[model samples]
Target: MRPQQGMIPWGPNTTAGGRAGTQGGEGAVELVMVNPTEQAAIPRGGNSLQSQPDGKGHFGGVHGGRFVAETLMPLILELEAAYAKAKADPAFQAELAYYLKDYVGRPSPLWFARRMTEKLGGAKIYLKREELNHTGSHKLNNVMGQILLARRMGRTRIVAETGAGQHGVATATVCALFGLKCVIYMGATDVERQKPNVFRMRLLGAEVVPVTSGAGTLKDAMNDAMRDWVANVADTYMLIGTVAGPHPYPAMVRDFQSVIGEETKAQMQAAEGRLPDVVVAAIGGGSNAMGIFYPFLDDSSVRLIGVEAAGHGLDSGKTAASIERGRPGVLHGNRTYLLQNADGQIEEAHSISAGLDYPGVGPEHSWLHDIGRAEYVGITDGEALEAFTFCTEMEGIIPALESAHAIAHTVKIAPTLPKDALIAVSLSGRGDKDIFTVAEHLGVTL
Candidate 1:
């Protein structure tokens, strides 16, 4: 990686790691999918479906391509074209901006946690208050945008998958606003734990389907949603909640959720007079991280940090530290880094935070990690819980378990940094939903 003007790239010794195939296998490439019922060769015309040139030679790769069966081809193509048109339209951009500001509440504050920072004794820690957004999380940001796009494309039904039920609630809320039918697939365990969100989605007139396959978690929910899509692709639009999906979903989700970065930039300038020395966010499927990291991509002065959930610890195979334990593979419509066995069977990831128990990350995250544009770290479940407790006690802020991962890093690094150095963390959501779970973990009986 070529060193930018004043930026200090972290991770590997040298930034540049060579081309696309540098780390992967060599010689002629071929993709074949074999199943119990069918076998076919995956099209390998492109190096990667996601790796298209973005004119600037910055490598705008599309990780997932449209690989649906022939029955859904026409509908998928139509939606793709509509997205292309929306991407090129200025009016669409303005409309989204208006909604973000007036409806969803844009420009969320970059709050300097004075009490917490003083207690930590190091860096000036700031919180990007995404938890204050409508529906109580950053998930609403992408849901609103996608539901709008779905409406524009004349789709009458929306389908989505959720891990902790936050995304399902957000998607259901948007569908209610647009008067479209919404169906969300959620894991049985999550539904049991996040009953409030499940109830909220139903109250919003959306159907909440509990998936029982496999471990009955995010991956199973995703598989159920995909099966639903393959069955009802004609009238349904799948509103993916993360930046890890195939093709346009990852790119589209990132673009919609990027308001976090946009707001952080402006708020930091007004509050601190400059960019932050570090921007930290928790990465599940990488949506929140991308949202907070996108604006800082070209801001060479800012350091990007992504925190992944280390269920027990990175050394523990039970952890959800994808960047730490995963390898490049295709899952849920994209070829990215996934935590799987040698035979490609997905592993069950454990995290105290249901939202952070994902086995794979976004392709852009994988690319950014490889290119050394961002640094991915892990925080153990105990550390995250400690951070959650610390923040609540010191700052009166109860962060979601997932967001606590970022707070954990801030706690570790804040005490060591100079007073002038600033840190911004994306508080992805509120912790009201996790109170019971935390209590259970802490052995505090309600």
Candidate 2:
């Protein structure tokens, strides 16, 4: 039976293959993924960069391409063409830019965490307060971009998957703005934990689908949404919440989200007259991290660090440290590192933070890790809780549970880095959505 309206629950004993099985066992399904090397050939005459598959060969290099099942190829091709045209049109870009800056509140503050920095006794910490955005998370950035693209493509409906429901809220909000029909699929567990956001999505006029498959997390919701897209591809555009997934999405999300770093660079330069010594962000599907890191990819002198939730501990079976425990494999339309068993069956990634719990990182992140351009690290649930509380106390800021992973690193590394060095961390979202969960963790009530 389909889950009831509002929120649902998922557990370790649950499975996501209910619908996916009828279509095909998600079993070892492989799709050709593009690598960066192949991207060079795409711009041959510069007829536009859409022709090349992202780095591996699926669509656009590094990011951009198709990853749907064969049944959805016609719709995928139509979307590909629409996106391609919209990308090249100046009017579309300008219109979207206006909404980004005005409607969704782009160029969010680059705040200096003076109190927190002083207490840590190390590097100065600056925060990209994406939490200030309209929907209270960096997810708004991508949703706005995708929904606009959908409008330009003449698409009338949108679909998405959410874990903590922040992305679902964002997508629903944009759909309301554009007067498009919206549907969101969410894990039952996530729905129960993030009730407020679920209500918010409903208030915005979206149909919320409670996903009952898998452990009822982000992946399960994604599977359900993908099935919907396959069935309704002609009129629906799947607004993926993160920078993971197949080709075009990873690249497309990064492009829309790059505004974070773009604003950060200008703000830091004006405030400090120089670039930061380091950039830090928590990684799930890697959209936030990639948004901040992609622009800095060419900056060899700056250090880039990505934090993943360590849940209980990496030493235990319960952890979401994909970089530490995962191996290279393919899942969800891309070839990248994934947390999987010996037979390549994806494993459940553990994290106390619902938003950070995922079994895979973005393909570009996999490449970044392979080339050593970025350092990936993990922080335990205990450490994250400490940092979460510390930030609220010292800085008077309530950070998202996921962002606490990066904050936890500051707790450990701040004392070690030079006091004069500058560090910028992506505070990806606000804490209102997490208040209930954190309250329960702290033995309190709202």
Candidate 3:
């Protein structure tokens, strides 16, 4: 692979391997028979009718209610109330916009990938350049909003879990911005693979705690963070990075992230004079996809496609293709689709992309998939790597491996469309952090 700025071939691998994919949510379609029939479980073009989650955190009879120990319930209740108030407060909204503009750099570009579009020979492709955001990637969008709420709740410390380290870095960035004590729990394996990000967090004055339990992956990191939150509920705010935790969290995070789609809608119409034919994003825990897909849900004409990580292949027993092959199960405090074995135990998820390596997806995503509001497909590691290379060479952009999954899928379908069609891919993050991973994948030492 060719080199780009901030990339050099002089050291051992310092970043996790390239991502397989990342993980997504719900609405207007319905909230009742999750999988009424076996045929409806995987619909063709989301054509099948189905039921889904209720307002009380139960999707299609799948409960997303809290299952935490009693000690944390009071704080959870308090958090729920605080969030409600904050959501309705004008002051909170104003502050959030101000930071998004002046600090996190809002209004990320929606650029037409002319070269890539021309190469594809059919659809006009747009890159929602979220990688250009201040802290790099869409993670900062949620981090800033959550930190603002944390400050409003009088919390003195911030705690979060991270997989590929982007969210951890973004959380650390906001904590430093707010002058709050920050503690980040990262899997020990992630810490090693993401050494640069670990140093970056420490450089920003956040403690990077290496979690050793389990496989020391993203799931294990989350477990450790939850334990920490319970131990210090009064003083610490558990800043969940994705839309998977519990009630209010999935909805809350989606609201904060909706900015991506909100911007995309206005920007696309302004640029193309019409809505795009399709909008696609990578899913790990489903934040970026939800952000981009939520605003377009009511627009029945616009297609929403979410790409998942098929680490090896769907039949390999090592992929993270939850919606495509997983069963409905509870994980990480929410009931959602998860990869599990016959014994009902959650299986380890594999993805070259650290961010997409989770056993389950957000509950709302489960609802969406069931109701046919959106469609999901899997992209393998090699395919994502190829897309990563193509984007850099063709569009002069190096995307995060997580984001590459979306691009990998986009390229496949875009070329088959008419020239009048438009396809937009959320360039979720920069790939500077994934150089080592790519090097490893290519049998090269950085």
Global CA lDDT computed for model 2: 0.76
lDDT of 3 by residue, 349-407 (tens): 99999999998888767767765768999999999999999999999999999999999
- Candidate 2 to truth, TM: 0.86
Superposition error at 397 for model 1 (Å): 1.1
Give the Cα error of residue 158 in candidate 3, in Å: 0.9
**Residue-level lDDT tens digits of model 2 in 1-446:** 11121221111111111100011112212211111122222233222121223333232122223455788766655655676566556666677778887898876888999999998899999999998999899998888879988887778989999888889999999988878999999999888888888999999999999999999998899899989988887788888888777656776787678777767766777688777889999988889998888656656667999998888887688888877778767777776667888888999989888888888887667666654668999999888888889988987889998998888886777789999999999999888777888888889977
- The candidate, 1 or 3, that scores higher on TM-score is 3
TM per model? 0.86, 0.86, 0.87
* Model 3 misplaced stretches (Cα beyond 4 Å): 1-55, 60-63
Question: Which 10 consecutive positions of candidate 1 have the poorest summed lDDT?
Answer: 31-40
Give, for candidate 3, the lowest lDDT window spanning 10 residues: 15-24
Q: After superposition, how far is residue 164 of candidate 2 from its true place, in Å?
A: 0.3
On a 0 to 100 scale, what is the lDDT of residue 221 in model 3?
A: 95
Model 3, residue 394: C-alpha shift (Å): 0.6
Worst 10 residues of 2 by lDDT: 15-24
